[model samples]
Target: MLPFVLSAALLEVVPSGKVPSSIPTASSTATIPTVMITRGQEQTVTPDWSRLSFANLPAITQSGSLNGQKWSAGQPVEKLLTLGDFQDSFKLQDLNLYAIAVATQMPIKLVKLSQFKLLAGQTLADLALAVPELEQLPVSTVKPLSDLLKSAKPSYRLTEKTLPQLLEQDPTLGALSFQNFDLTGYTLDKLPGLIHAPLQAFRHWQEAKLTDIPGLREMPWQQFPNPPSDSSMSGVIQLPTTMSYRLGKDSTSISGSSALGYQIPCAGCTSITFSDPPALQKKRWISGLAQWVQGGISDVAQSTTHSEPTGRNVFGKAFKVVVTEVSPKQAQTALYFRFCQFQQQISCSPYAIGPVPFLSYRNGELMPVGNLEIGTDRSITPQMLPSVKQILPTIPTEIPSTVNHWSELLSQILEQIKALLHPPATPTA
Candidate 1:
């Protein structure tokens, strides 16, 4: 939130002849009026060095009083000026007018102008003369920008009527932030003269509801001090010629030669295009134990009578080798491969395989069919090993029907994982 700092105090002086004869006179000390004139709510004034030490200390406190009694003691007049006339009479020398005017002009530096309260029907011209540096003027009625441009302030924000006027005076004034003003009814023939000014940043211009910006045929390339390295300026230059002609060739910085060759350059000088990975890579990987249960590949059928197989090695290979019976540890590896392939096909291949669990198989004792011994002289490739560390939960001695359910769940999990790894693309009808 913007801080609002109050400016100097205001005093309403009345002629002494208006004081009633019935009023009691001061004896040893002087008496001061306690009444004050207020436009809206009465505001409290904090004392500063100058105001605190003033001779009329009593009058200072009464100046901010809400009641009009302060002026009652002064001479009566035939008529009193309205608020507009009073504001019009404002002189630079008057401390009240001077302070408020300065406050209105440099609002960021000095916030609330407590002395001057704008009444209805006031225009920007009225405020501009008093506060020349003011970038904004909150007025009740919309007025012409020509009145505002009579002074050289960079910006002004008001209703719809004033926007065209503002643009007419200075189109290149960049960085406009406005709200609730409708431009739909107006026929915008062209953009303003100030469009050539380097517009570095704009806050909410894209969100605005402007139907036509006839001035913006070509892109504002020079506006950004440093554009993105891969940005293409061609589309910006090829905008409708109707919009271009209105902007005027002189008003836009882009030249015909530059617009002709605005294509972005890449490593191979080829236009970049993106595609999705093959669907076959989406299939799940089975662990050695799961593979045995699902009958994906038979351990007994593929194994040869070699050395003795024993202990944990016997059970480890029994569960893990296929897509359906895969363990969580092996499932993670398959998912990672599928994800990488889907995003960057060149980096991943269809030949990719998950880790093979090491287990022991013996002939005599309940011969753990489909299980291989850990110490067996079997060759493995670096590419076959999981890229990441395998985090295995306590291996279940008994396989359950729930394993199939888990496999189906893995498909959904892989889909979510893939979405995070890739950018959103247009959905096919």
Candidate 2:
């Protein structure tokens, strides 16, 4: 049933577009180059069937033009069928070139499948059957394989139902990709038969809300190219206790093991009990205008005051003072001070002078308590110092001043503390 005539004599077809006298032939050991069959203007009527001899052929390539294509091969001659009208169609009974290409591990290029008028319900089934050995197929005509296997290439995307079909047809798919699909509400129960599939690698498995897969008792984790980290899978809640799999991040967790059960004991959680006391709350108090101003003046007086040691050896005690004032303008100030009992010891004090309608502290000099350059030389003497009124002139009376003024004041306070703790080195002689 060969469509073209064949003879024992060799035939030669010239590149000048003329049929030659000799036909090309090759030995079984010789490697065969890829063959391309293109539909020309001369061939208009679609061919119903075709055949291929795979005995000496290593590979073949097929392409469909405006007409038709078909092929078949085997001892009884296994036949392949491609049925498409003007476009492309796949038929189980029709032997087409595309079928031959696939069955022979060759390549086939079809101009258009949709252009051909295909019979109802036959196109998908025929294509599926014809390309049984096809490892890669474009998702243009059908849904991607990712939707079928929960694990596919990282970039696989197909309709929800397509995955089941793919899995049913071929369970040996190795890699799967589902980069950005939201599997929020989908559960493992929706897909019952995937446990037997040969899917080993999965990306974005955590994005799928799969609580448990009872059918999947073990995983072929060794086949995973890049397994997921433990943290990636740790967020998955309520996994089956009997299931066990190694995570990509090098941490292994056994489901039914005592270390990881219904309620895992969190270490270092002694202070993390539910019955712990609530954190302490902070308190704030309000003061009248008179009290506020009075407190401020008292603070100024105490800061300017000084004390001397009593002759009876009762250490000199600096006067303690506090200022809490809220002005008519809503400005406020809170200040506190405490004096040391020892003559040589410095006073420890704190002051919060703000909400000032305008006034801010400035620099001033302190008179030493004693003339001797001993341990108490740095101590200020209240007797020799002027009153708070004298120091007020040196302080700023401006309101809403620059923030730098506050910073400078805080810096001065810090410097004073530092000097008290660690006195400046004596000037090098």
Candidate 3:
């Protein structure tokens, strides 16, 4: 019936008096003696052991002859459990907890451990039925009990009503692992402590501010459909250079009907593919690519008519991207681009990049993917030239930008190619 309180101060609450020679001290080799609690009166004790001070445990029950050895309180609990009668007892979770408490030097009501053993694998409600004092246990005792029972108990479907009371009982439970928890209506201001839960553990938390979640800001942002309210293009990987593109059309020869067409046959235009695309709407890329081109081209005359997703089956599905630039000097340049879902079959082709890492565009530099080589002049065939010439004059001349001559554009492009193909020799002293 001794209370479970384990603190060095618990031993200091002795009746104020002169030191008893019978009681042990710091250097004494005397055996520890127990103090009896008188009915309706307080009992006092003092710590007189070495640095290792623990509560004076209640008297051992059923002493002697444990697994062919004399069982006593002096022996370690682990050895007693390992090679003692408690082997069966150790299997019980409640006893395991009591063993933990005893091992950790936490004061425990040893007499109650047997009762806990009887209720092992049973619910807290079941334990409360027998103990009645279970609810009244102090925080020190309750925490370990909660931890032991956490995995055993059925997952709690927490709601606004139940969450506060559960957290009030033990805030550490906020971090407990729960499968498929949904916090749809919660916000940081409303449940700040809930941040202890992992960001990925809960669902429908898109309502929460992205900045509020730790590590979320650093994740690679993909152009997925139905993004969170705070989602922005700033985090998406930017294409380093607009010059990454090359002019080449679909190489596949198709004789398919338009109504059932799966591939767009552009003999001399740009053909591109986005392999393993993220959950994205075509509009997101269209807007993103337009902004990228405008930003990269300051003297932009006009960027118009990026094609829609046609059932072009070159790789899988394709979208046409057309960017026509008219300079101040009446010279017009156009890029015909085809973007598609890169399929596995494309990998068999000699020109194919093994896997597409990323897709985005910027100004003045080629993209770093393996397949950019497909659109270079090396892939252009004689049949593509007439189609290229036919598409040239049809490009709109309305938009105007600072005009660089064709020769200058070609020279800069060649320099970029030369740098990629042949590195400058390292200077040595």
Candidate 4:
């Protein structure tokens, strides 16, 4: 074994170390490769700070780890690395250099991820390249690579038999939007593990369960021994369940078993993004969404004004529409009706037969409204006193001036007449 002086102590401002003194001893050209560090019997100290090419990288070789100290390239490796396709260990910080787009053009490849073996005292974070440009990796290396990265996707297209074990190590991996990935659909077999995992990335992965992946509804799911708490599953804006034993299922729809049901991601996807800085931002979004569903739309509807209602043909001079805030019960019922409408529209469930409401689009969704949104979030901008007279469903309310469905009103009147005409037959005596 030979001991060599590290290059950190050298000041090589003079292009490649090939030229000595204040001037050159060799032709200075960009194509000429400069070796940053040397190993073996040759005691050479060459340092050049000029345009480097991948043609000549560090002089360290695979056989140079003879001392068993896990010797990596010398300090000058950084100057050479920008040239691309490096094949050696790097300080944890330098790992990100591989992401520099210009550097990868060189024929040299980044570290061989397959043969990647950890050196003692080095954690995966040390080799974790934040912006990895590689597309695929060996299956066995996937976990280690996941540990190294704590995430993969958007940068790399990953696929595996399972949902990346790195998910158990760090659920944030699901936060990334993969360009394309061949992964397993969510299953009851895996859900419990994710529910109990400590990492939020696992929870995020669970959130992705809200997706309508094929065959997921058919998976056999029963209450787990350790079901996730409300806090764990809250950020999940919507989830699909063919299982009746869910956290807070609509029991009416869950007869002895669950009828198919699914909720989508929140209206604003940014709240669910993994890149969100605040850990609880996702949770806050769920809370806000629940409030919206429960008719606590907050200040998004305060700008309504002007009450001269006009509609003679369909509505006639029957009623005057008044602007008012929706109560929690009204909001909940509206969402329920909307959900039923969506279910029927998709042809996915058994709908409770009821008269459908006429609809309008106030915020992003179409629901029953009279020139206003029933339950919109704080993010919506309020509308002004424009003459926007949109038609609405025949509302069933106690409001004195409101109109009722003619057919329903006729049925009520007929029942009243029958009761008056046929008083209970005189009690027999």
Candidate 4 per-residue lDDT over residues 1-429, each given as its tens digit: 111121222211111111111111112222232233322222221223232222232221111111111223221222211101111111111222122212333111322222111111222222122212212333334443333333443364544523334444556654443223222222212212211122111112111211121121111111111111222112322221111111121111100001101111111111111112232112211111111111101121121110111110011111111111122221111001101001111111111111111111111211111211111223322441111111111222332333455445434434433222111101111
TM-score, per-candidate, Cα-based: 0.17, 0.13, 0.19, 0.17
> Tens digit of lDDT per residue, candidate 3, span 1-429?
111111222111111111111111122212233222221232222112222111221122212231123444233222222111111111111222223333344333322322222122333333233333433443233433343334435564333333334546666554443122222322222222222232222332222232222222222211111111121112331221223232232333111111222222432232232222132111111111111110001111112111121211111111112222212221111111111111231111111000101122233322221111123122223432223222212222222233565334434434433211111111111
Q: Give all candidates' CA lDDT scores.
A: 0.19, 0.21, 0.23, 0.20
Question: Per model, how many backbone clashes are there?
Answer: 26, 40, 15, 8
lDDT of 1 by residue, 192-279 (tens): 2112212111212222111111211111212112211111112211111111001001111111001011111111110111111121
- List the lowest-lDDT window of 10 residues for candidate 4: 332-341
Comparing 3 and 4 on TM-score, the stronger one? 3
Among these predictions, the greatest TM-score belongs to 3
CA lDDT for candidate 3:
0.23
- What does the lDDT come to for candidate 1? 0.19
What lDDT would candidate 2 get against the real structure? 0.21
What RMSD, rounded to one decimal, does every model reach?
38.0, 43.2, 34.6, 34.0
Candidate 2 local lDDT, 1-429, one digit each (tens): 101121222111111111112111222214322222222221111101122122222221211111121211111101111111101111111323233333444322222222111211122333344344322443333332334333434454454344336546555442232233333333322222212222111222212111122111111211112221222112221111111111111111110100011111111111001111111011011221111111112222244322110100001111111112222222121111121111233222111111111111111111011111112212334453333233212222232246787556545434433212111111111
> Residue 281 lDDT in model 4?
19
Predicted structure 2, TM vs. truth = 0.13
For residue 202, give model 1's deviation from the true position in Å. 8.3
Measured by lDDT, the strongest candidate is: 3
| TM-score (C-alpha) between model 3 and the true structure | 0.19
Better of 1 and 3 by TM-score: 3
Q: Higher TM-score: candidate 2 or 3?
A: 3
